[model samples]
Target: MRELHEHTTTTAADALGEAEVAVLPTGSVEQHGPALPLGTDLFAAAGVATRVDRADAIVLPGVPVGVSDHHRQFHGTLSTTEETFADYVADIVESVAAHGVRKVVVVNGHGGNTNALRRAARRLRADDVAFTVPWHWWDNLDDLIDARLDTSLGHADAVETSAMLHLTELVQEDLLADAEAGAADSWGREVPGGADVGFDTADFSDSGAVGHPTDGTAEIGAELVAEAVDDLNALVDWLAAQRFEDLRPAPHR
Candidate 1:
């Protein structure tokens, strides 16, 4: 694995100079019901990123906290303001850009950071810092989920539990029974017109879980991870071969 944390100064410098893109895993330290770990998002992000087969990309150390204020009602949930998180992410990308890395991919695991990451990507593009994109692992792995699991993205649910299972020992396996019992099945309650109302997890789920945790299995988790890695590998290859000048906006003649 081409990981920044494991590289020496000289080797890192050389690698950075030649790297086509740097992959930065960003996640949250938030509640994952009774069974999953607080670091579930981070673990998923880092695990997928590190497993990607990219010789020209460097997988940077993960940002283990994010905009998770919605989950703050749960214990062990740490969060940063959207502004703070976006700025921090922007700075990280800027730092890497300064090191001559023209392309950067923020492999994100937290849904809360979506808006913030989009804003950051826009800012980076406006400033011409680099071609930066925030890739949510769950968002990109819908097909895999459809094939391997019965549901989509859900907090501390089957998908997440399966990922934590793949991490080995990160999940509280003993508590899964309780977690499954408390799973909420949907994101939130919808109004008469089908519009979903926004609220904290405590307002809906008694156990802070939003899906079926019992549906998760380590075998499925491994498949999901492999699917993610393959997708990322293809993305990195495409990004590496693109010409920035051709992709940049053209001025009016």
Candidate 2:
């Protein structure tokens, strides 16, 4: 499939009429853990989004920056106000809509961006704009993640690190080997005598890798990719069949 990054104006235009959907990867750059790069969310979303089998639909460049106000307490964090972020995203959809795309899929990776996108999508719809829905990877893969992961080295924990390992072998994980099964607890308590310290990724281990790196391998990441691609493709098919009002009776029905 041709990627948006590789297409000329004409090719891009042509794909619009030919393709049923347009994909926009939405991600963020902030602290994950010492073991993972700040761009982990961005790359993970990219890895999965690019793998979608949308024949004529080309993958566009992802939104690399996002609202990171929560992570602003950490170093090297760049965030934008929610309003600014929403405007930026709205502009993206509007710019792409100029093409023949009647449907759009914003593949969101960060947890923070979901509500904002929801609000924006609703507003756009209320204005009679044409578009598809925002699909959050975390929400979509909840069933998969729940079956595989427990509440342990979370946030910058096991699942995320494993994904990075699978997508790029060069990812930093020198400290992942020290993962502590349960770092922080949901009750706002800490695991007693855990190897980790304080931080979103802390409590799991000193360097912020949660659970066990021993449990993580490139193979698992590959499995996640397979599952994700399969499910997302199904979602794309469903999106293609949707109407602005599935609320009304269909002619066949």
On lDDT, the candidate that comes out on top is: 1
RMSD of 1: 1.5
Model 2 C-alpha lDDT per residue in residues 130-153, reported as the tens digit of each score = 464787655555666666654333
Residue-wise C-alpha lDDT for candidate 1, range 40-99, written one tens digit per residue: 999999998988755689898899999998888989999999999999999989998888
Alpha carbon lDDT of residue 163, candidate 1?
87
Highest TM-score model number:
1
Superposed by TM-score, candidate 2 places the C-alpha of residue 33 at a distance from the truth, in angstroms, of 0.9
lDDT of each: 0.87, 0.67
Candidate 1 residue spans exceeding 4 A from truth:
250-253
Per-residue error for 21 in candidate 1, Å, reads: 0.6
Specify the poorest-scoring 10-residue window by lDDT in model 2. Answer: 180-189
* Model 1 local distance difference test score: 0.87
The ten-residue window of minimal lDDT in model 1 covers 243-252
CA shift at 137, candidate 2, in angstroms? 1.9
